[model samples]
Target: AQTIHQWPVAEIKAVGSPLSLGCTIKGKSSPNLYWYWQATGGTLQQLFYSITVGQVESVVQLNLSASRPKDDQFILSTEKLLLSHSGFYLCAWSPGQYQDTQYFGPGTRLLVL
Candidate 1:
């Protein structure tokens, strides 16, 4: 059975500080992973996607970065946190194949202070 896990349920950070969030998908190899952010205004935006380990592509311009350091792990990091970056984040994954269904793990809520 495949399971995806995202860490740190929430965070409150000051502006201009660095941040990192991690996700790991077990029982799958080279899963296609995605990072999503939903702002306080209720926009569900996709930030990044990874098709394989060590390769990540940005889907939108959100001033954030993502990487896959392991076949089962994905990381999202930012050098600085912005007020506009405050949002609820979701990490999702799909089997690394065409037309597979995607599933989301419990997310992290970020509040910028």
Candidate 2:
């Protein structure tokens, strides 16, 4: 079975401070990884995605960046997180060959002060 795990289920950060979040997928091979964010009461937006190791693409770069350093791990981080960056962050994955359906795990919700 495949599963996804995200760290620091909730975070409170000051505006303009560094931030780091993590996601890992297990039991799947070469799965497509994605990062999504949802602002307060706002719809989810794709932040980044990767089709293979070391190859990441930005779907919507809203003052954040992502990296896929391993086959099963993805990282989201920033040197500075804006107040606008406060929201729910989700890590998701799907079979690389099947791009239609993606599954998301528990997300990390951040509140900017």
Index of the highest-lDDT prediction: 2
Among all candidates shown, the one with the greatest TM-score: 2
Model 1 weakest lDDT span, ten residues long: 94-103
- Please give the range of 10 consecutive residues that has the lowest summed lDDT in model 2: 96-105
Q: Model 1 residue 82 lDDT?
A: 89
lDDT of 2 at 11: 99
Q: Name the lDDT of candidate 2.
A: 0.93
Q: Where in model 2 is the C-alpha error above 4 Å?
A: none
Q: Model 2, range 1-113, lDDT digits (tens) per residue? A: 99999998999999999999999999999999999998778888999999999999998868888999999999999999899988999999989785659999799999999
- Please list the C-alpha lDDT of all candidates, in the order they appear: 0.89, 0.93
TM-score of 1: 0.94
Off by over 4 Å in 1: none
Query: What CA root-mean-square deviation does each model show from the true structure?
Result: 1.1, 0.9
